[model samples]
Target: MDDITIDRVLKSKDLLNLTDEELISLVEQYVPSQGCSGAAYGYLQIVSHICYFREHLQSKLMKIAIRPIIYLGINDHKEVLGFITGEYLIEKTYKPATEFGRDWIIGKLQLNETLLKDIFEEIVIEENIRF
Candidate 1:
């Protein structure tokens, strides 16, 4: 996905108002091919924005939109989890349902527990968050 596309999606006020077809089309266009880290950052930005802005959409719709991007290799999945972790822990912007949705995405991605633990620990340390 290009920066322009990413920016457009992020700036949109009516994200959740999009039809399922529109959302799926955006996901299809935004998800990069495997091993395409060059576009991964932009893709991540878009996905994070979707997660934040469209949290009220059905879980099935979110799964449909996000499932394809999970195939972009383990590293990319880790990045997504890491970003979501930051949003949850540091930003604290997620509502309960949004947090559950993000956790569901993480579960679907099947990332390693150790990697997730490490990511959480690293973020806590970086942000100096107390237990």
Candidate 2:
């Protein structure tokens, strides 16, 4: 990634605001090689998992939503950046990133449309808690 791209990513918004296609594009850009499916593989899984859960989370009784959190550490002997679901850390949401993975996630989310209307509509619905 270039300096300009890095700058854009640094200024990008949150991940839940990105469209599915944009997120996929970011995944492709960061994990370019089809042969070595490491970060990209994990990202797609995370997206799918979150989207799948969005419905169940919408229940009045349930009242929960999912988002990815990045973690930086050493994985498989390489310094890795990872994206995972949930506001905080969890075993299931862990997916190690590498190279320019962090930038891609942040960049895609930044080039936003205010909301994701299609695949994630329920996830973004405003809660009217009239307490």
Candidate 3:
């Protein structure tokens, strides 16, 4: 909620609506947090955590959405497959690979596969799309 929190988090501020248990599950696989300082840094860290968690959630959804396509070209066209994935990510999440940073995006996937899939299903249905 602080001004310094990443804009991506601000863009989808609904992240705060998730329960603490859901938030904890989403962040369980992330790399350690980076150094930050300031009176508002604590607030910013919480916001950043939510943003990172949701980004991973988006990635999980995208991987499932594109799994069939990815499998088809995983061996012969890995780079092209990456490109397609990036494009789909931008289309669905509105965040480009460049903006999100490939290292951050690829690191620390969600560990709760079944839970994540269920949550994604609940939110992605026709009536729930929030764009």
Candidate 4:
């Protein structure tokens, strides 16, 4: 996707107004061609936008956005998942909102269950930590 298209999609105030199908179509058309890093960035951008709009979005929309990231490559998954997990760990307000996104990706992608379990445990520990 060109910069113009990316801007148009990302900058649109009507993003939340779009039907789930339309949102999924936009993600499918724009995200995959950007290659691994670019695609991961694009997926994160979309998720950030969605998170900004509401604390939660439809799971189907989140799943559709995640598909390209997973399909791109396993290494890319580390980058994307790391960023999401990092945000959750550091951002006090993100909490279960980020958890929803992480869980959706974990459920959709075929990755090592044990590694993901470790990550989940870490997040749980961090969540219970007090200043």
My TM-score estimates for the predictions, one after another, are: 0.40, 0.23, 0.27, 0.43
Task: Tell me the spans in candidate 3 whose CA falls farther than 4 Å from its real position.
Answer: 1-10, 19-51, 54-62, 71-81, 84-103, 106-131
- The most accurate candidate by TM-score is 4
What is the lDDT ranking, best to worst?
4, 1, 3, 2
Please report, in order, the local distance difference test score of every candidate based on alpha carbons. Answer: 0.45, 0.30, 0.37, 0.47
Q: Name the candidate that leads on lDDT.
A: 4
For candidate 3, give the lDDT: 0.37
The sequence of per-residue lDDT tens digits that candidate 3 reaches over residues 1-131 is 22322344435555566655454443343222232112112222332335355564544434333323333333223332343434433454332333333333345322334543453444345334432
Q: Write the per-residue lDDT of candidate 4 for residues 11-122, one digit (tens) a residue.
A: 5666656655565566656643456545545565565455445434434344444444444443343554554455432454312333434454444332444443444344
Deviation of model 4 at 81, angstroms:
3.6
Ranking 1 against 4 by lDDT, winner: 4
Clash numbers, per candidate: 0, 1, 0, 0
Every model: Cα RMSD to truth: 12.0, 15.0, 13.4, 11.9
lDDT of 1 by residue, 41-89 (tens): 3444455456555544434333433333343433343554554445332
lDDT of candidate 3 at residue 106, scale 0 to 100: 45
Per-residue lDDT tens digits for candidate 2, residues 1-131, read 22323123324433345544454444344432233233334544433333332323212211111111111221211111222211112233234332233333344422322322222333333422121
- Write down the RMSD of candidate 2 (Cα, Å): 15.0
